[model samples]
Target: MERREFLAALPAAAVGLSLTETAKAQTEAEPFPGFQPPGVDRWERSDVEAGDRPVGASFGTRSEVFGRSGAAGTSHPLATLAGIDILRKGGSAVDAAIAINACLGFLEPTACGIGGDGYAMLWDPKAAKVVGISGSGRSPRSLTLEAVRSRLRNGFIPPYGALPVSVPGTVDMWWTLHGKYGKLKWAELFEPAIAYAEGGVPVPAVVAYYIRRGMTNFARPGMGIEELDNARATFAPGGETPGVGEIFRNPDLARTYRMIAEGGRDAFYEGDIARAIDAYFKRIGGWLSYADLAAHQSKWTQPYSTDYRGVRVHAIGENTQGLATLQMLNILEHFDLKGAGFQSPLSIHLQAEAKRLAYEDRARYYADPDLVDVPADWLVSKAYAAQRAKLIRPDRINDKIRPGDAPSRGDTTYFSVADRDGMMVSMIQSNFRGMGSGLVADGLGFMFQDRGQLFTTVDGHPNIYAPGKRPFQTIIPGFATKGDQPWLSFGVMGGDMQPQGQAQIIINRTDYGLDAQAAGDSPRWHHEGSSQAMGEDDPTLGPRGLLRLETGVPDRTAAALAAMGWKIGESDGGFGRYQCVERRMDGNERVYGASSEMRADGLALAY
Candidate 1:
């Protein structure tokens, strides 16, 4: 069959297989036919001391892990361990993912929680197909563009507060995904999170840093003082944020988990917990109501993909900027990324230009599919990408860029799990803008997400705030398949840095032949475009055009980019943290490679 024909047949072939049959077939055949082994030159020595700790040695660096039975990688070590434990107990990839997400809510509340939203891509080995889950929440039924504009300070929504609160969708998403793909009981999934929340888990260094940062920002004058007090009461407790290694407990969250465990999703969406959330929002001047919560339902949509060098990359459609990642990848595929060299000025410049073009389209047309018509298919088409790639000039930065005529279109914790049963899951959950909208429900032990703040008040805009509309989302989970079977599951978390990271990771693994860990750890470049009306800006961002490169990028490459009329600077965080699990078959034996973000306090574990 022709490549296009095979691409067209993938969905049907994947959906028709069953878990047992898929695994059996994989064992009988050579899984990755054209696979290339990792090159010897790709391995490098770590700068951090590995032996007994000496003075000035870095304490956080670690190595990637490999396994044959099961593997899991997440942003937190405890979450990774919890997922591995679930896998050991005969759980499916979805079950392990749910367990990991539950643990992350308590352990890394700054990134995700039941009070936020989530998305996932599940690879059904037997059926040989991928399934996408849109766990995003809708705006409050009462939220209107007029009401939003009336409250805007300068035609832009506040980063936090009641105006940004959307209906909590993470719990509903959890229940929905569990009902469809989970092997363990619903209540069993919450046990790890509940125990940790009630029995105090030590604050990891990264978690401690974010908690302190939150306290400082929230306590600043002119900020939300009442919300800060609630946050302090729950996270600080002793008049200060907890330090690294210090025990922190959230009894309220524990109770919330128990209630949900007992009554299923309704416990949070319709019962006493829901009542508490409604009361808290009402008192705080937010629009979320019981009706919003009651009406919320997670959608099981068909996953979308674009083929790059024979590998198909999949991401959730609509209400997400995920398709933009594929668009960027499609554009990048038109060039020889590996031939240009990793982190080379030519490589970085092309990627930045492609991303800028894709984002322009995103800002103009991407939004909730139910609310507006998005040319999803046309956006990722190679012909469209080729046309967009033409706008990328090799000699200089393109400043006159605008959305193409053909079609407009287009953070948070991300983790991946692959069980021994051949099931793999790539999932991301988030409370937009770390720690979310500061409004901690009176006794819920978690803060609500500020996702609604992303919506614009511009009349007729696709992402304009509206009743029951899902605002454009940044948190996305990514998956890739070779020959219509699970090959890679990964995600990179951080606002606009996500799609950039996704494109780079795919290039590093597929083109440069790097393993999962190296692909994640390699120097990253964040394309900082002009700040949108509702966006935040930093010194590193400007209209002159900026490409924030992580420390690992060569100074020469930075100089080259600068000579091309692009402002280049070093970035502190926003580069994004990545985690991935790649499944490779050696004959009939299934091998798993897992990676955790080097910038994070986590490790990849397999058994």
Candidate 2:
């Protein structure tokens, strides 16, 4: 058959298989780009030293766990262990997840706190379905566009800017998920996060890096550095950033978490903590109001899924660009992309164009569905994919492509849990940026999420700042299945690069036939336009290229992509790390995890 005819027959052929089957078949015939190890991954150890302080070193000793089959769970070690314990004791995946998340709020305070947002995707084998939960918050009504503009006019961005000052929705989301799917009480979930917080969970290396970085940004008066100091009385009484190996504690955060455990979500939304938060915003010129807290809620929605080869690709819908990942998959499905092989010039060019194309649609149309007329169907149509595919030239670079649809946007962490009962949870949580808004309610101890700062005040923009609107967010979770069979539960964290990373991971596994870690470790690339909106640290960061081979990618592939009109940037490979778990067909299951060695401290655990 001619190439086109052969390609034409593929869809019909693929329609008969599940994503897993198609991916396996493709891998059997042509291997995807496997890692070209520069040296043994240096940071593969279960434990390691990190940070400038002793507390950082103590964090290195923690372990992360991955498991498969009967039941498995993975997250930061403390959270993972907590979830695993819950599952072992008869908790459902949702139950374990809530427990793990609550623990992370205590142990991983630098990335998330009670004052943030969460998003989740779940797959249930018994029902053969997927469900979404949006725990993100809305902006305070009192903080209207004009109110935000005044702050900008005063020569201040709302802490990261007014965009992130929205109401926090994470607790509401947790309570909602637990109420519907949880087998354990919401109070049970709060145990770990509270004990870790009050008892002084030792600071991890990554936490220390952000703590020091946050201190630099939060030191201004009225900005809430004093709250951190007050919260850290047990952990860092001397005012010095806790060093590696030191015990770090937060009695205040512990007390706050305990109130939630006993009082439920209402503790934060209606009680003293709420008052402290409202008072803090008032004093600091922030826009959040008591009504915003009273109005907060987490919503449940349907997820968008597409068949890539044989495996089902599922993601959160429109309030986020999680579907953009699916749109990219849909576009690439039209071509026999695997025939190009990974790392070849033609392959690199095609992937880059696919990303550019998808992002174009993202910038032009994606936003909170309630607030905008996003052409969701049109954006992912096969016809649109084919049209976008034409923009890629087999021989040249397409750097001039502009953002057509994206309206503009995390210590967010992801953990996937599956219990023996067959309940699956794909959960992600965050404070928005590292250390969040840097404002802690006086006695609350936890930092607020700067999530609101993601909105713009510009008139007519889809994601413009408004009274009670949710901002563009980075924290999203994904779930997938093959027909009625549970396939995989996963998520990746990074700011604007998240959906891009999700697409890359799925493409690597489904199209390229790589395991999760390999897909994660392989050289990766993201379009430059998205990176530019993130401000000076990101925009002026430098020239970016397609196929950034992790420090582990073979030099040959790096050279190949560079030769293909791509500017290659080499790094220590520590910036991007992913945690993933898979349930294989062999009746036995496995959890495989990896962290970027490029990061001074990252650990992947499995048993």
Which candidate has the highest lDDT of all?
1
- On the 0 to 100 scale, the lDDT of residue 362 in model 2 is 64
Task: Estimate, for each residue in 1-607, the C-alpha lDDT of model 1 and write its tens digit.
Answer: 6966854655444434787765555556545333335433122333323354332212324456889989999999989999998999888889999999999999998898988999999888777799888888999998777888888865677777888888878888888888878899888888999989999988888888888887677777765434556777988897978887899999999999999999999988889998998887788777889999999999999988999999999988768889889999999888888889877999988889888888877777778999889888888788999888888889898877877675333148989999988888999999988888887888889988889878888877778888898988988898999997789999999987888899899988898877677788788899776533324334245544577887667779989999999987657677999999989889999999898997777778988
Q: What TM-score does candidate 2 reach?
A: 0.80
How would you encode candidate 2's per-residue C-alpha lDDT over 1-607 as one tens digit per residue? 5966754656455545787887776677666645545533233421222333343222232332444423444445677777767777677888887887777776666666677888988876666788888887887787666767766623324555334567788888888888877777777777777777666656666666667666666665665332444444433468776755567777777788788888888888988778887787777676677778988888888887778788887878757768677778877777666787865556656766677667666655667887777777667666767666766667666666654442334366666777765667788888877777666667776777887666666667677777877777767786667766667777777665567777777777776776555565556665454432422123343323333445444466667667767776645332344555565554554333322212323334333
User: How close is every model to the real structure, measured as TM-score?
Assistant: 0.88, 0.80
lDDT of 1 at 517: 76
User: Which pairs in model 1 have colliding backbones?
Assistant: 14-127, 14-128, 14-129, 17-126, 17-127, 18-126, 19-126
After superposition, which runs of candidate 1 have C-alpha atoms over 4 Å from their true positions?
Answer: 1-63, 224-226, 407-411, 531-544
Please give the lDDT score at residue 447 for candidate 1: 86
